[model samples]
Target: MNKKILIVEDNKTLAKLIAKKLQSALGLTVDVAYSMAEAKLFIARYTYFIALLDINLPDAPNGEIVDFVTEKNIRTIILSGNIDKEFRKKILKKNIIDYVNKSGVDDINYIIHAIQRLQNNAKHKVLVVDDSRVFRKQMQTMLENLFFQVISVAHGEEAIGMLKSQPDISLVLTDYNMPVMDGLELVIEIRKTYTKNELCILVLSSNEDEEITALFLKHGANDYVKKPFSKEEFSCRINNSIEALENIQMITNYANRDYLTGLYNRRYFFDTINEYIDEVKNSGEKFAIAMIDIDHFKNINDTYGHDTGDKIIIALADILRSSTNPHDIVARFGGEEFCVVLKNINQYSAEEIFNRLREEVEKFSYHLKDDKYINFTVSIGATLFNEEESLEENINAADMLLYNAKKNGRNQVVFQA
Candidate 1:
């Protein structure tokens, strides 16, 4: 339950400093081991999110510690005094997250940054497309070391199929030459469905042709790497691309989400619902739209205060989020009013889902000062959409039903029946 980091360095002073910084800056539990034997003991006792290891330990001077820790499946970033080209390449081939030279303060800073980056990497998924089974497996292992969920395919066509199946995939690493579809064609096709900000593409090639690299970049690739790249260079490029995409996504998300509860804003909800309708029009799939409002929300505001009311609204938002499918859209229409769009469902199923949510809200008791407590309820109105109907008509019908639910009773779901 506790997030911890292990530091394995013979230099006591340096080890203490690193542990201090990790504890103070990141609030992680830090354990320091001065030798390979000690490090193994720590590894056996506690699970670590990551480990920082000095290559030349007293007990294991030939970088045996790297193999020992990595074999345990703990993510590692190696610290080394030697930066020889061959030595670095050999270290990288071992599938460590990264290897940093122990030079100065900048190196320590890089370690800190790498730790943060790996933490963020847990939320991302990367797709690796290579024709060679050996190359694909190698890449998957490297990516897994960096704490990313990897989906690998043999060729570009399978890569596209994977992308369609997993829309949340954040990065694509593709080989230039393949059987079914080549990398260049794959990048061009991917760009058609996903924009530059939504997905990042990295091309790997043995081709020395300058024009090929330029062409891939011109088309849609975010970065290009030569086949024989050092582990440092490969990890750095991948991290840079993913970081840039995440920054852009953060800004775009803020624009689309409500400022209060972090749910989709009203405008985004409308736009997405229209897109959803367009998507299902030819398939003859049914969907439902629901409008939900907190019952007597103003009374809660008057009794407890606006702060408590906001908490209640946020609580209800959490309920809606947990109750619906990921494909279903839940948004804050405004104030105490919320909206949800249920996909691939009829009026009956939608009613069942919303009624369950209503029961959850009723069961939750909000605590106040001096052991005081209060309960809240929500009224929901929903309607199934017909292919002949428009978005506005469905919303209006749902809204009218919601109004009727509030009028008839405080806590209930009102639909066709």
Candidate 2:
């Protein structure tokens, strides 16, 4: 489908010219609006992929149109003739995707480039935490306009719940002044739970004092946007922050995930288990550890090539990942073996889970190079942690039970007493 672009220029001649040029040059359907009212009407009627906005429209001066465009979140380029540093700074301060000084020649190319970049870039998800319905809705509209998936919560507590539930959230935009836990308090709480590498947070405040901004940044805020910001400026800042987060996440994934099976690597698994152990020690919550091995895996690898063995491992990883909860830690434990750690699970529930997983593996099938397919089962040993016992003792008990399960039968679940 052809992408849509909205041109919000008050000059009838300029609007028509830009609209025609964009339509002819890029094959975009360009909607021309001469006033903010007309622009709002257009926006209400049709969703544009990108919007070219003039900040100084007759109806709303001081770039009110920028706010409206941002609230709508369509990728925006500000075409402003006002070159004053303060005015430019203010206009660029909100979530406008780009700013083009209209005074220059052939700067229309900048809008084209900005639109192209926005289209090619990945759509990011932002969680907006604010108690104000008006602000939440406003931010939601703006983010959606830019093709971002937005999850909005009315309060900081709700935001925490959202973050815990959705680990794939790309960024968080939180209002600093809110009821039911203020922004700074929320940031500290979230930081305690999720490391800086796991999540990125940005604080929004009406108070723009340098000292206050510094404080917010110190308390794990990736960035801060003062209230009454420009749409173009806000977009630039948001993009910058998201880019930084993407780089960090890429590095983190490389360091923490296993390459072949796409499961948590040994180091990450140990780090996570240690954290769980600490929590269990403090809170007396139950936890369970399981050791799993594909039955006759070595024979299969010897019969078929190692490539086929690798495929089987990858398939098993997929099955395990699908069977467990996101909070459960699953890891490739070298060779053809895997491990699962379920936090807050009692002995009975842990045995049941191990049995289910074992049954699933027995029923799972895989295909090889010549359309040759094979089915296999897994043997599992599980042990629940008793607060009286040490972490290593629990793991060792599980491992011993696993060996017994393999000895008794190739595909079964064994639980230690």
Model 2 lDDT per residue over 185-254, tens place: 8999988977667778988889867988888889888888888887766777876777677688889898
TM-score of each: 0.88, 0.64
Q: Give the runs in model 2 whose Cα sits over 4 Å from its true position.
A: 1-140, 149-195, 198-209, 225-229, 282-285, 346-348
| Collision count for each candidate, in order | 0, 18
In the range 75-143, model 1's lDDT, one tens digit per residue, is 888888997988888887885887789998888887888888888898899999998999989888888
lDDT of 1 at 42: 92
On TM-score, the candidate that comes out on top is: 1
> Each candidate: what lDDT?
0.90, 0.82
> How many clashes would you count in candidate 1?
0
**Candidate 1: residue 246 Cα off by (Å):** 2.0
**RMSD per prediction, one decimal?**
2.9, 7.8
